[model samples]
Target chain A: MTLLSRRHILAAIGAGVAAPSLVRAQSSETLKIGGMLPFSGPASIEGRQIVQGLQFAVAEWNEKGGVLGRKIELVLEDDESNSTKGVTAVRRLIEREKVPFIIGTYASAVAIAASKVAAEYKVPMLSGGSTGAGATDQNTAGDPWFFRSWPDSNAQGDDTAKAIVNKFKKTKVAIIHDNTNYGVTLAEQVTRVVTGVGGQIVSKDGYNAGEQDFSSMLTRLRGLKPDAVYIGGWAGDGANILRQAAEIGLKAQFVGSGSMLSDDFIKLAGSASEGFAVATMFEASTPNPIGKAFAERWRKSHDFDANTFSALGYDSTNIAIEALRRAGKPDGLEVQKMLKDGMKDFPLVQGPAGTTAAFNEKGGVIFPNFIAVIKDGKRRLDV
Target chain B: MDLFLQYVANGVVTGSTYVLVAVGLTLIFGILGVVNFAHGEFYMIGGYVGIVAITMLKLPVLAAIAVVLLAAALVGLVAEAILHKPLKSRDATNSIISSFGLAVALQNAALLVMGPQPQRLNLDVSKIPVLSSLPTDFGPVFLPQQRTLIPLTMVILIGVLYAVLKYTWTGRSLRAMAQHATVARLCGVRVQSVAVVTFMVGSALAGIAGMLMSSIFFVYPVVGNMIALKAFTVVILGGMGNVAGAAVAGLLLGITESLTSAYVANSMRDVVGFVFVILVLLFRPQGLFGKAAERS
Candidate 1:
């Protein structure tokens, strides 16, 4: 199911020597695919995942012969996770690299910035990690050139209520967040879900980012005493809460949004991370064939595998390739048209669908989330 | 009651950090007769150097702390000699202006080497036993290692500073210079050399404070802004150029900040800390521990 990669550095080095002719030939026949992601700074972890995912699919695609008759020549750039840098990376990828299509710039701020550039350039840009609605919809009818692979927070949360009822049967849960808009929105989603399911939110608490203390909040939480606490925050503050909970013996099962499935969270929490369950859009540790293959490949190359962000990138790359194949020409306008037509679950070997991937008008995968729990220092499927 | 205990615990820890920061700022003013505006960047340097020592060089935490101190001390020595000495000898304002420039340069240098995202030591406070001494649950107000260590360090540091200033020949020289630099030079005191050491010691303390802060606080590039500014307030509130004054002021500032953040919104903690300093300054323009005859 996976290729046994040999360390053919000599061959690859030899290929590097002959790269000029390949470049010359590549110029004539290859379709330039640009990629921009946060390769440095705070968001570098997610950036690396996106790069790996894009590389994996691109390798697999080339292995099966290039998209259409032209080889995909990917031009990668680092946005440093800044919106300003994202614009520079996108502009460089567009004007300098002359990429006909692009698959990146993951941060919402970055995605929003790069999409504007893509719209300006009239190049089809698909971002998997950027969940900001503005990435796709700000100028949808007027522009139509910009697109996103992942659904924004609104769509993801719309399904979260049904997910809570059908999946966890969670009745009474507490929602904790960092008081940021992102955190508040996510908590509101769970709150809506819990209430809609005739469940009660026993408590809700919010803390500021970079807060060193959480004792009072946890104490307040102990009194409210819900079945579980859903943390709607990023790795740093959320992990601190988790650590504090373990120390204080606040033993309501900890649950969180997809952010909990990230390696950043796991790295921060360490062994204390055990028994933490999370609703994730994707988990690389799944028992499926795709999961098994990704695990093997990721392990061979690096110590840590792709988290949710990596899966998002992998999904995005395959979507771009399919859209390219469907579009036939390397024309950005044609590909944008194809993307708007809605890809109804084209054979994503790694997706929830065996061969189906579709985004409703909202550009969200109706695919089920892989609920995971940290058991024995590794993620185990809860459902 | 639990929340109260936790807040108290947090206040103590928070107070300790304040003491360290104030001492750094106060020491410079005490010795050089100049406000070292770049003191916060020294704190920033301490964090970056500590991270590089621990993460990049794979040194022990103690080694990281020591390395951060030594590295920052060297930077201070260089700044005093090449930067401060030339400028100060020219006039007071030149050194002051140069120090601000130095701060900007060091911060950008740090930003160039290590990007702007926050860098935690990649080590948890709970992993270190001293920090987790208190039961974990006392809710979130309890000091995890990162929060607890700074206060403990402040105690040890304040003790060391006391010992150095009271007992050591070097501290005597620094004191002599602080009291009367030109007169001390006539009295066979190495005033210039003492000034250099004062800067080094002050910087070393700031660096140590920064390293401790990395664990407790969000160790970001801009952390210098928050801590350095607090140190300034602490120095002014304690008594400008007063070592003993700085210590008392630091503790008071910390408790005030912690209580304020706990009771008021966390964001208002800074505002309240400064408000106290302003109120004190309004009453006593010379500062809380104001001493006449100390000109630099």
Candidate 2:
């Protein structure tokens, strides 16, 4: 083997150093949008669906010659459904990837955590999956870069409590929520609304996520003799609760947030899910032309039918694209301003027949919530 | 009074599953002296096995249970031979770390195979003739036919285990090994074979528990995480390596959690176990049922 000279070694080192920057320069022609999602953790399944929606919207936009005359590119980072990891992922997107805007996050805690970093970097971060109200609560005057396309948990909870009180005419309500940020925030909203309407909350309790046995809790709720029970948790636990409640002969109207509006809930709860009402923003049976097209496209690609999270992901990506088009540049502050002021009566894949989506002053989405009930193993709109 | 009885019934049923898992863990620790952090993964595997046996193979409930047990035993044998046996002479921490790695690997394997969706093991009690004939509603306590199966299975399995441990030659050898491994081996106990048997039995117990609970809770990849934590708690509360203590502690912890959820805040139900464990550790380090370490 021939020994390398100092000049040859120096040339090799220089090439290695220049390689990454050269690649970056070439890729700079494409407008890069960051996606922070839980692609490999507990919420990975939901993250997969959201990514699909993001990719679908990006593909559609690219087909139409991309945004700002630049080919749109998506830079993805896995947050692992964790708060700390979410912050790290968002920082990488803003600092390393240098994307002007981001779309993501399934978990509320992750969304809330990552949005702080996005706000610090002055990058517009659009959340499509997280429903917790705390994410938008961080959009202050000093750092107003977070926007949520999906309706918050408070909206769903408010509508659910109204349905239980005014529609179902249930005075004594018991609330069982998972002890997570999303569940707790939603439960608090329901409690506030129910008590505000002269309704008595007999028993309000929280259970850990993945808890299967709700026997004692249901038995205790039975003793309270409440007219309705509001469940604020994931679909798995909610299904188990419904089944256990029926087994213990706890006869009360069961209501839940958008988390319950899934086939898993109806399938797992079986006959117990009959008449179980949930307040949701997105339904597969949405009558809107855009929603119908999205659902059809989703079904054509994926084996299963489109759900709320996917619709949220698709809508949020489209919202970001629309803002970018209106802003006429890939500037973060301009994109944020467009999202805040320009998106008035924006059409969404979610909401009612004639309902439109808009961003309120707090960066939260203003959309109509619908109450649906499980009827003969199918979720049908009740109100 | 009826409400109290109902809560108690609920506690007992929930406790039965805990006993099954914790007893297996205790037995493995007692005999092999190997802290199997992967014990919960066996339970998860059992649920998946049960689902496959029933859904894909179209087996009856009894046949599906047998399939789960056999599959779990095979997996236990492989795990013992490869993961445990090779590192047997090394530091105990080595085995523990290996088992922890095994747990992660097994969990991810299950996730890859089953996907992330939670699957229900639809064992219809109405279809079972004997179960259908039994009265479900007893005064104030309403125990569903499916739930009643849990305690019944727990009693039968524990009884079989107790009988085997008390009367059989293998049982005597196992007890001897638990008492003193070196002395037992010197007395021609065939330590290696006995260790394998102990691991298999323990894994089978955990697997069966998973199968039973899956019918009620539904089965997911990470389904065993919470139950395994509860089992470890039971193992500690009852005194590690003490089978009888595990049984008692499992039932006691279950009742305590149920009562706490009913009387106290439901949110504090899981916290009760850790708190009790801390109290036990501070007050009685030898555990409630565990005797003081005796010199041979």
Candidate 3:
């Protein structure tokens, strides 16, 4: 009866006008994080593994009451590892979904392309698996908007070089990598390190990704007879190279960049994977208690053992959430700043050694790389 | 000299696999007049079948290959019935579009069932008694005994196929149909039946190639796409409907790739192969074996 009066309606309208922040406050009940990955393409395996990590972390957070008492929702768009698709996916995540935070892009090229879009939109995009140096290079214009949870290619390459020179004692090393940005950059870094450490570089070869035949390369490498062959590529290619190398009796000790640190590689390579050493951020054998707990839970839930990929993905998600909690709100710009300046010593949910995940000025997560070997068909930390 | 010979040996090993894939594609194109973009998916399915047979069913290598061939043949027949047969009478574009759609669908379906991870077929052909007795090395070339078996297997398959096409009624019918479908039908060759046989035979060839290469390459859904593209290149270079031409072209392409990778830069392998194809096409637009009138 009272609302029927014009004066009462006017009074209610006045109250609504006075509480201008009410609409903004109500919309903050759920935090959205966009995910960009090649969920249905050649890189789909990497995408699926990365998502498991993100899903596990997000689920755990939600179970314990998500950050700031709001549920975290992941909005995933398949990039298919194409740069154009990556840009389009990021645009959708930012403009259409309006997600404040995003995590994505196992492939470095996709990460680089998508991060530019996220940067232009002033949204924070974190990559859990991309390690191409250019992914988070401050030399680039859009580096501020991108943060990575994995060590850069240089870190992995340096670790690989050190392992080759110290453990394998291979002064003459051959470098083989895919033609992608990640592969080329890692190969270059490894070459530099191999040369700088008083080691000899035998030959550097490049192969297209997804190429099954490496007989020619293996035969040529066998002729060179390098002390070791360093692979700057993914698990799939690495496994193939190892198999072919064994088939051709290349005899070189096969070493790999961080990308080769996957159960898929060991499984694919079979007996050829024996004694294959790789530099990785997460070694399941020497996982911290937190990592151990995460891996066990991941295995139980996903029915697959967590690899370095899953661990990095879970840690990246944890890092994003930590930054959000530190920001005290889901503002994208604020979260980006907090991720860059505030998360220097933040303890990651997963790390290979005792070190915590720390982002440098370039927003790359810095952690000590450890050497792992596929021994007896299982990846084990060697040192 | 040994290194050069080694490269040649590597080339032959790779060439034989290409021959199998290219011949299958050419045969399908010859009879069905459909490029069958999904031809590669058959190869991928064969790899997966080989994996399952060997790992899950614990079958011997030869037995697993047989299973793969049968599975691939069945897949090809089903695909022809469901996807190709309906559009066979329509404009050629319809068949192309339908085949393309089938390729995408089959690839995604494989991804769904097999997941994105690559699985290796466990075939220790190197350990087989007869294969192991053969020299794994040829001069300076360190070819695996298992790998040597692949070329030999391809030779046997191709010889059997040649004999079938030259001597058998079904093969003759399929070849007649490949030359001219309407004429083939008018001659009471049963074009539809020939189409089925063509698809089966072509798919079996691809399946064998997949089984042989799966160990070397590892099996994933997208694996077939690359091999299929290479096969297309072979098909074009050899003449779309020319099976023998495809075999020759496939070997040529493989050897070119290998020699380029060995003597030049490894990255130049595909480039050289494609460039050679373009050169050949420019000189012979109807393809190496296709009739000049067929160019119309």
Candidate 4:
């Protein structure tokens, strides 16, 4: 209760004034964005492409002045496509890094898990290549914080059907999938879309992941003499399908989901994969400056060519930064609201010219897609 | 009928590879009386070596393969010196725990060195022709250059192993030690050397499988667990201590799994395979070809 000296009080007041600016400077200068993707485990090959794309986006944005005049820092954690590990990783990003935005959780299951944490914090989260529809389907009321740059599974399947009916001109098609949520959903979508358009499914088969030989399925397919075969899978399973099909004497035209659009696929299937076609979220030669830029940057950085997710990653980050700019701050709630409004329209260097992310009352990116065929062991426009 | 034939074709391709891995596994276990838990790691290591040789170093596929096998042999030698020799005549629990630790270490090391991404490799030779007589409707079954080499390699490997075990003094000593350790040691057979050789053979096989698989399946760090599980299954199915049984059981298991995948829902095929294994265990614990003494 004794009276403090006037000089002591002034000194304490000066310290308080000095600390506030320091805190504000630290907070306003850096915006931390967490990235969770399968950098290892089964999907790591594709996951690496995803990570590279994300990096390219961040690099481009930082070069142009980061979100809201602050440097955007990306902190990546490997989920390995394990749902449990995904949740743990997102939790670490949220609680430890205090990231207001997250760019990934590539597999649908991992995305579902990570989005739970994102929903809890009202933070904005987006994915490049998870097409299970489960990633974006649950929010009938429209998820405020969850947005995706890639088309939904239903869209992909419909696109595949379009290719089959309009392009392939085939009356009967066979669908073989890995039976995961992505595979089965896409297969079902394609089946419905194809049959709806007067095309019949000659055969359908589902296989397990890590499956080595698809000869049995291929054998059945060969006997059906179907005009075409659609495979929906990736990694070890996807590669082996082509390998086994070649061994089993299957001559039908092969089509696959986005999962087939990997460099590893062509390598594993060898020359047998030359005539395959796939529907993917992106094509390296998207005829867009943004797509070209991302592709050029990526090739310079790694030996692998650009895949669909790489372009999506670039677009997703571009949208995130746009929202950040509109919000004028990296606050999760402010950025979430801005993103939901879909304010900016910067054409990213990915696929066909597209505006900034526009949500159709649902938290999904209404981005255009491409159907590329593997000709001569490379992905080229089917046309 | 065509579909069935196709499935059989698929099974044949996969079963052939299983035969190769299983045979190598059984040979080591038969002679050493020790389970090399790190066999799968050796395979993974071989894959990495091949990738580095071919992709980064730009070596021819065959040279890369040779380099991988050579590296694998060296790794096997190291395993023999450290794991097998040290554990010889020691407690089973100690060796099991130690070798398990070694396997885990090797897996992590692989992740560290290779950066945890799957890499691709192709066969040096062009595609093989498994059978040329099938009709055009049979489609174009790949006789992947690797598939043709598998059987030829298996024969060469078996013959070499047999020659080493049967004709050479080293081969005779290994058999003598395996059949009766005390008497073989007393009769001037080098028990320690034979055990070391067994470790070497087992590891080298795993490595060869790993390298060869890169041609058929993509290779990555997680592959160790996969190869380990399948190889272990093959060993148990054929009788853990029966070399010839392992070779046959592996092919049988591979074929059955392929057939299951084709006929059943893809996911359920794994369940069916496990179920079959359980049924087999319940009925004949010694496996299909396992003998009385070889039964584990």
C-alpha root-mean-square deviation, each candidate:
6.5, 6.8, 8.7, 8.9
lDDT of 1 at A28: 58
For residues B168-271, write the lDDT of model 4, one tens digit per residue.
88878877877778899899987777776776677677777777777667677657776677777888788866767777777677778777766765556556
Q: Candidate 4, residues A108-179: lDDT per residue as tens digits?
A: 888887887778977778774576677777654544566876568777778878788778887789988876
* Model 3 Cα RMSD, 1 decimal: 8.7
For residues A1-383, what per-residue lDDT tens digits would candidate 1 score against the true structure? 00111112113322432353365464557667887876554455566556777776676676576788766666677676677877877888888878767887666667777787787777877775776566666655634565655556666655554555556676678877866556777778778877877878887766665565565456556666677778876666677778767765687667766556676677667666887876656566554566556657666755776667766777778787888799887777777767767566464434353534555453444455556777877776753
**Number of the candidate with higher DockQ, 1 or 2:** 2
- lDDT pick, better of 2 and 4: 2
What TM-score does the A-chain of candidate 4 achieve? 0.87
2 against 3, candidate with superior DockQ:
2
Worst 10 residues of 4 chain A by lDDT: A1-10
List the per-model TM-score of the A chain.
0.81, 0.85, 0.87, 0.87
> In candidate 3, what are the lDDT values of residues B87-143, reduced to their tens digit?
788888887788777777777677666866888876776556688688766667677
Q: Please provide, for model 3 over A166-258, each residue's C-alpha lDDT reduced to its tens digit, 9 standing for 90 to 100.
A: 878889999999887778888888888888888889999998988888888788888888998899877788888998888777787789877
Q: Which of candidates 3 and 4 is the stronger one according to DockQ?
A: 3
Clash count per candidate: 13, 0, 0, 17
In Å, residue B18's CA in model 4 sits off its true spot by 2.3
TM-score of chain B of each: 0.91, 0.97, 0.95, 0.87
Where is model 2 more than 4 Å wrong at Cα? A1-31, A40-42, A69-71, A287-293, A296-304, A353-357, B127-129
In the order shown, the candidates' DockQ scores are 0.20, 0.40, 0.39, 0.34
- Give the backbone clash total of model 1: 13
Cα lDDT tens digits for candidate 2, A1-383 = 01122123223323432343345446557788888776555565567567767877777787687788867777777776788878988888888878889997878888888887787777888885888777887778433577887567777788889889998999999999999877888888888999999898888999998888889998888888999999988777888999989877899999986767767668889999998998877767776677877788878867877777778888888999989899998888888888888887678887765545478777877766778878999877754
